[model samples]
Target: MTGFDSHLFEGRTVVVTGAGRGIGAAVAAAFLHCGASVIAHAGRDLSHAEGDLLSRVPSAARSRLVLLTEDLAAPDGGAQLADQVLARTGVIDVLVNNAGTMGGRIRAGEETAETYDHVLDLNIRSVVALTGCLLPALRASEQASIVNTVSISARAGGSAGSALYAGTKAFVSGWTKTLAKELAPDGIRVNAVSPGTIMTDFHRRYSTPEKLEATAAAIPLKRLGMADDCAPAYVFLAAGSLSGYVTGQVLEVNGGQLMP
Candidate 1:
């Protein structure tokens, strides 16, 4: 919990999706701590924020926080969120596409068309739609940075029951690179943060304690990661002062789990 410069993001506007809890909440709070006005999409509800996210922000900074709730898996979810953002601000300094989920385990061969739609809708379609909808605002900034949330599972192929989720992340990893190149001319940098085995509710619902312990034992650092551990990377990637020249890269925050 080291402190960042209070004025690092002064006068900036940042939008973070999936900010109700876990990694998204930490990233949103980090921007608020650094003096940015933030628009946080709190998933489908505010239940997770009551205890987890709201407590993390200082009262003084609360004035700069705007919370929105939308189900990104719905047909027009991304567009709806973007409309809200546009109504609030004309320009965006940072966009963190962190709203995504595995939607539970659908084992191989047992995957239904319904499951496929849900996974893709939440993970891939929503991201594309949101980013596309916000491109003009992003371009309006003198310099804008997009930090997407990918997963180590994208590369490792993941363990049982998560192949579809892994594929979506892989798609995002590739899209991040492609968007970096496509948007470079507009002075917008696109990159991604690929977290490895974070100990969030994501794992609580999708993984067993035995499996998590085994993962920790196998990692070179002998532990899984925490949401705080991944937050600074987003801040670094989002701040032009910090990572102005960095783009199209997947920064790994895995506690040495994957060297690549």
Candidate 2:
């Protein structure tokens, strides 16, 4: 059904972090297409243009697409971003903590303290801080939802990237459940999307197609996930009727690779 007819998120405002590309970008586009005003965010590189993200959002939704840039790992970065979003949108109904970075090019002990700190800061701390920073705005809404991006590596311990990377995402999965309960009384819902072997830029730079395909074949679905394929789950989580009763949960979008 058209978003207007469904009223899934007719007048809602959503902020999607790391929205310049990949799954983040796709999720933002899906929300905008479905009638939610969206804030497209990015960190450092490509934060300004958000080329691919801008291209995907239909012109009709452009007015609702606000591009933002911030370093979420920094102490006040999350609060700063929230202020900017609030200044423009007035109220935030949904938050998708999709910003993250991998511990690229590392070996055991070769991973420096700086790199380890960076990974944890960007992947874990930011997710928590951003959510917390935006909580006040979210509380004002009648229906509020927060979706955090997780990974199979977080569950399996490690597949690609450094061990620290996996650990950070695992934290998100764990926090989502507890946070859901903590915020339930406040009328807010928290959930996560743990993606497995998706075809993203990072996956390509680290794991080759052959390796990814092999991994996908192992799954019952027999294919790695695409960014577009993962978008709907974000929509579902934000759609109160679709996920109103759902909170403190992790929806694994993996192709049955790590069935739990």
Maximum-lDDT candidate: 1
lDDT of 1 by residue, 52-154 (tens): 7888899999999999998899978999999988999989999999999998898989989888988999999989999999999999999899999999999
| Off by more than 4 A, model 2 | 1-6, 47-50
The local distance difference test score of each candidate is 0.93, 0.81
Mind sharing the TM-score for model 1?
0.98
Those runs of model 1 whose alpha carbons end farther than 4 Å from true positions after fitting are none
Expressed as tens digits, the lDDT of each residue in 105-153 for candidate 2 is: 5666788878887788888877777788788889999999999999888
TM-score of each: 0.98, 0.92
- Against the true structure, candidate 2 has what lDDT? 0.81
Using alpha carbons, what is the TM-score of model 2?
A: 0.92
